[model samples]
Target: MAMSRQDSRLRYRAVARLHAENIDQGFLPILGQDFLALLYQAIDESPDSALILAEEEGQVCGFIAGALDLKPVYRGLLRRWPALFLSLAPSLLIPTRLWRIIEIVRYSRKAGKGEAVESLPAAELLSVAVAPSCRGRGHAEALYIELARFFIERDQEAFKIVVGSELEHAHRFYRRMGAEPRAEIAVHGGTPSTAYVQQCADIHVSR
Candidate 1:
């Protein structure tokens, strides 16, 4: 049991580093690796969320995090608020960073209230990324498929993903994976993000 926990922690650290280095457009990476690691740990432990990884010879090459219901994921994080707060405290000292956090929270709250043009599934793909060296490989798609399997096994029919409008490569990737753009909104004040929905009803998962 101790070894399993240790291995999980190590995986979290590796993916956190990968996320910070590759998913540069996000607000969470700015909080540093410790915060990101803790966040991934929470996702792994949360019943409503999942953290899936693609490893190469035991090294984490890519990862994806998602929740069947984000409210429960938020509750899981709140349960670990003390540790999360400790990890986030230093960033709070930066006014801009603090505001960005507030913006994220407000955005989440608004989305929770059904502010979208059409209602989206409660299940959502929170984050996905692959290391720069592994980009041409299919690790990203594999991780995504695994997460879709996670949701499908839980009876979730569809899942949503939000990508920054300027990330053309990411947009293309999701579209290729059969996710259709459903709406656009800004999580931060001026940064527009497009939300895409992937229906799992027709997706065939071989693994």
Candidate 2:
């Protein structure tokens, strides 16, 4: 179903709840309260980040988190204020920058020769998930469509995403969306993940 921009608040809450619940699971067992607070802060402070949720009959069934690239800001903060990184050190070790390093390495190796890393477009599709009961109902696709529209409305030229090898279904879904495999990078403590890129100019959205 098509979603209205006015529903952003509801979507954000649902997405935040899903993210908190998932983190509570095996994804990042070490994420403590402080880390979660920091994460929320990051999202709240960034104009580029967004939380999107899918609902049916007034009940939230799935959600997706997306953001325009804001890494430069964080990186600058880390460099200028090393103490800040140190303050969040414990949390970083578990599910922040340090943890992401592992994934990057794994993906790099899988990317093989001739593949080069490119800067992601300003827009990115970060994370997406559906409730167990809502599986196979196209909620994920619907959410993606919403994200694309969001970017398009902002005049973004492209969008990108990273999908782990373990998420076979996601890989297929993205392929169907006309995303091309761009690079492979190792995810620390896990297998390689493939990076995919899709140009909005090439995407044909049907009404």
Candidate 3:
């Protein structure tokens, strides 16, 4: 059955809420639900990006967001900058939030210059989250497999996942998915993160 426009909107909104509630370490979550919904919608709409979700009984149980080339995703967001800026206005007023945003921009510049870490693929796994109630299920793994298929279909050989060092559970999850830590880096100064690289060739998508 084809999904209606209203169902698609609800899924995006659910994705935003799940991200904020589950992805606590990221600066994007601090920007709040409205911004996240818009961002995910953009990712779904962008040719360079992909957003995949696991739904059970019409509820979003998990979701993964990624891009083969971030430039297009960035362009998509920038094209809608006015609404995104307005959505982020309240968070921008907070000094800590503003500083994080600046840190993110600086990190992006460094990454562009190859100063952030060793050479890595242009394709990236931006964010993945599964709701707590749905944790024991295979939702996370299924979403990841689907994302790997997404990259593979795009001819992306490899992809990277940047996760907070403090997130041991996340590290374990990635490890289980056959990703290996490639480098230690910080998106925000002093806060450590591990960049994990996953080779798409190794993924077996039973289709």
Candidate 4:
């Protein structure tokens, strides 16, 4: 659908609502309960994070979560003053904060083993979902385009996405977005996950 100023307010509201609902329902399934709190903090504190939602008649049709890595900043701070994150660790270990810690540790170990470089400043195209009734209406593409613009504005180096091995449709969609397969990480289940990367410079250079 062609989004216009006339639909902007309604669309914004739908985006906010869909964002909250998706965090509570959609993300929980994929990230697991162990990682939800970290996901929440990542979205809340990262200035580059955003939610792009498509709406029709005040109803949300689709949404995607975009997040940038704060690792660069964290690493710098730790290097300059080693005690900061260490001091903050006590509070982060409280029952409510432990989940994010667990998630970071788990992902850090995975990153160490995987070929995907964890040191670069990267953005994550975390999740995307379209309402069942709104499938095949181009809303998904619109949401992604909006997110691409947002990421470009931030001068991000690259955007990373992970897709389940069996989801051929999603794989094709990411390929259409110019994301190339970069790595594969084996999950607990027999199926491995595919990681895709699209560099901002590459996109601009192509255009």
Q: So what's the TM-score on candidate 1?
A: 0.90
Taken over the whole model, the C-alpha lDDT of each candidate is 0.83, 0.62, 0.83, 0.60
TM-score of each: 0.90, 0.63, 0.89, 0.59
Question: Between which residue pairs do clashes occur in model 4?
Answer: none
Candidate 1's C-alpha runs over 4 A off are 1-3, 112-118, 203-207
Question: Which rank order by TM-score, best down to worst?
Answer: 1, 3, 2, 4
Residue clash pairs of candidate 1 = none
Error of 3 at 29 (Å): 1.6
What overall lDDT, based on C-alpha atoms, would model 2 receive against the true structure?
Answer: 0.62
Model 4, 163-205: lDDT tens digits are: 7787788888888768888787654333478878877555422
Tens digits of per-residue lDDT for model 1 on 24-137? 887788899988898788788889899988888878999999986656656777888998899899989999999998887776666645566348877889999988887777
What lDDT is reached at residue 184 by model 4? 76
Which residue pairs clash within candidate 3? none
The candidate with the higher TM-score, 2 or 3, is 3
After superposing candidate 4, which stretches have Cα over 4 Å from the reference?
A: 1-27, 30-45, 70-105, 108-114, 118-121, 187-191, 201-207
